[model samples]
Target chain A: MIYLRLFWEFFKTGLFAVGGGMATLPFLYDISDRTGWFTHSQLADMVAVSESTPGPIGVNMATYVGFLTGGQAGGMAAGVLGAAVATIGLVTPSIIVILMISAFLQRFRDNRYVNGAFYGLRPASTGMILAAGVLVVKAAFLPDGLSAFDWRLPVLAAVLLALTNLVKPTKKLHPIVFIFASAAVGILLELSQ
Target chain B: MKELLSLFSTFAKVGVMTFGGGYAMLPILQREVVENKGWATEEELADYFAIGQCTPGVIAVNTATFIGRKQSGIAGGIAATLGIVFPSLVIISLLAGVITQFSELTWVKNAFAGIRVCVCVLIFNAVWKLGQKSVVDRWTAGIFAIVAAGAILTKISPVAFVLFAAVCGIVLQTLLKKGGVGQ
Candidate 1:
């Protein structure tokens, strides 16, 4: 039963987490809320581990979740199962449509109604992305919950946001720079206190 | 065994180093797979990227598996994927149990806060860049907008948005092609 649950949970996550790895953030957040599989802090840790790991952040996180819930087998089950199901789910629909409509792909590309729908979707996805950011901010910065918001949290956010812009044109700069910089500031603040 | 190990390490390097995943791995993947080692050619990499995108489980993972499979079949896929996942498993296993305790540490908390903020920026920048790639023309722009909005607005699943977008994109592309859109 637990195995089945894990399969379903990740299958659901993979099937729906369209925008690839980062897109999984929203679904994983949902799972965290739905099942007490992990806490918000744990989710942040998952992000850290996922980010620092070798595979896709989404898969790594999924494997971690599976391992936490059911152990190694569970982890592999979740990773492979979810990935397989999700990938199939993602590909099957499009492939079928494409193959069936192979003759008409070009004309179908220009429909005005389709255009309008997509135009609306962009801002929507952007909003989802922003919402995920806000959630992360709350989880990472205000571990004590949002109502007890601290100036330090938002200030830290602003500083990083500003610093992120600095890495400009040099986007390839290692993620460690931000991590180390943030760690340094954090360490300084602690010592000062 | 050595070939499998290389597959694992190469992807591990990609997983650890990259701030943004998926599309972000493209250049690094090319560098490692194509340039550093003669693992795969530029064309093969491109094919892998296309297949990876169309498939699932983080572009990085999919590509790793594809290349792995290409090099050594099923064993290679498992090996490459294992390489990708090993780090996350170890790191999360260590921290997940006691993360809240660490957050209670002032400096630790602050550092995380800053990292979260940085991650937010990274996520945004990556999305924006991808959005540019995804929105090629008026039709594609529409599909992207529709998918983004659908993802944001309704409680529709994210998978739905992608599938729907692809369907719409393909359909639009098909229709337009009939109408000489592709040309």
Candidate 2:
């Protein structure tokens, strides 16, 4: 039953969580609210882990959620199976869609209706991504766990943001470098406090 | 068979090395599929990404499928898609046992706090670049503003937003066609 439920939920996620990985967040938030499979704080942690890890964040999240839910029912084997099922469920729609597109893309590529719809979708996706970015900014700065806003956090974010942009944009540093440096800063801040 | 195996291995490598999800994988994808393997041309890869973004599901999976199908057939697509996700399954499953407790630790929490901030910056960069590309004309700008506001301020389902945008585009394009206006 859990496997069936996991597959069903993630199939829907795969079908509709359009635009990319972050677009899936709203659905995952709703899942948390409705199913109680994971808490919002856990969702935040999932985001952090999914972003840090290799692979699509959406896939990582679905697998994590499945593993947790399955582990609650059984043990490690169930957890691993749940992870596999959930990942497959999440990618199923992509496989289907891609196959359909490839089949008809030659004939449909110049279709005006297709073009028009995508014309709209392009900006809409951009908006969704922007909203996603804003949400992350809000979470990063105004975390539910933190009762008080430390002004220094925002200053730190701004300094890092500027550094990412201004520090020789031509020969840009890898994002991993920034991630590690920021993590070190975070640990240092915690230590200082 | 050999080509399919290589396709699988190449994408598996990409899945392991690339972080930050689909957008971050773009360069690697271009490198492996377009430049290295000659499976797709640069323009073809760009087209794949465009369609991938608009279509349902993960961009990485969709792109892999596109290239895979181009290379062989349905089997190739399946191979590539599986390859892309194989690393995630193995990695996430391995991490699942300890991640919960590990995340709760103070230093881990601190580290996450920092990582989240960096993620925000990365998202901002993605949005800025996407906005420049997508929000070009007046209608698209309007669509962007409304969708952005709706997503942020309301509980409207994202699926609904996407459907509404598609409908709006059709209507707008139809009206423009009737009025003899160019998009």
Candidate 3:
């Protein structure tokens, strides 16, 4: 049942998550709320892991979530199977749709309605991703709504934001570098305390 | 048979090199599929990227399937699609197995906490860049505001929002055309 549900969830994600990898975040959050398979914090970990890893971030996330859920349900073997199921579920729609599009590439490309839909979709996708980013910030910095705000994480996030965006030397650096650096800082901070 | 293997291997290599996300894969994809393999021309790749953006699913996977199908057939598309995701499946499965086992450690927990904050910031940057590119005019800005507010306030499915926006785009464009207001 878990496997079936996993496939179904990712299938919907793949089928409707237009834009790119980040577009899938809202759906993953919704899945977390519905299934309780993972927490928002765990979803954050998945995002970090997915971002730093090779291959597409969305595919990495789907595999990561599926593996974790399956490992919890059964064992390591089930975990691998779950990863496959979820990843396949995620890509199944792309494969089908792309193939269909391939058959009529010229027609699809020239369609006025298609262009119009994308014009609307682009901004809407951006909006959804923006909403997802806000949700992530809340989950990371204010887990218990506004009442229980954590200053330390927000401060860390601010420094990181400055380093990545404001600092010229670091602005062009790969995200993996920032992620590893943050992890090291986290460990060091914890050790000192 | 040879072509299928080549499709798989080429995409597997692209998959391994693609860091961050779909957009980051563009240069690598251009180099491998266009410059090296000649599977697609530069303009064709751009077209694929544009189409991939609107279609459902990850843009990188969609591009791979597009190029692959153009080369051989549906089988080629399947091969490339599987190749692109194979690395992620293997790598994440291993990482997930290990992380789940050690997630109880205090140090591991702290590291994840920091990583999570960083991830949040990264997503914020992505949203900012995307907004700059997509929210060009008044109508788009309106759509962006409405969707963001709806997503934050309601528990409705994100899929509904996407579908609704698509319909709105078509209708709005058609109305504008009829009114002689060229976009």
Which candidate wins on lDDT? 3
User: In DockQ terms, which candidate is top?
Assistant: 2
Among all windows of 10 consecutive residues in model 3 chain A, the one with the lowest summed lDDT is A184-193
C-alpha DockQ for predicted model 3: 0.43
Q: lDDT, candidate 1, residue B51?
A: 38
Candidate 1, residue A45: how far the Cα is off, in Å: 10
Model 3, chain B: what is the TM-score? 0.58
Candidate 2 DockQ, CA atoms: 0.47
Candidate 2's residue-wise lDDT over A1-193, tens digit each?
8899889888989999887787788988888898898899888989878865778888889889988888788999999898888888998998999998898875686888866776777778778667766766776788764666777677777887788777676226655566678778888887213
DockQ values of all predictions: 0.18, 0.47, 0.43
Stretches off by above 4 angstroms in model 1 are A1-172, A190-193, B1-3, B17-75, B92-105, B181-183
User: What proportion of the true contacts does each candidate reproduce?
Assistant: 0.25, 0.67, 0.73
**lDDT per residue as tens, model 3, A92-144:** 99889999988985467668897777678777776766676676666567655
Provide TM-scores for the models: 0.56, 0.72, 0.64
RMSD per prediction, one decimal? 8.5, 5.3, 7.0
lDDT of each: 0.55, 0.77, 0.79
Which residue pairs collide, candidate 3? none
User: Interface RMSDs of all predictions?
Assistant: 7.6, 4.2, 5.6
- Ten-residue stretch with the least lDDT total in model 1 chain B: B46-55
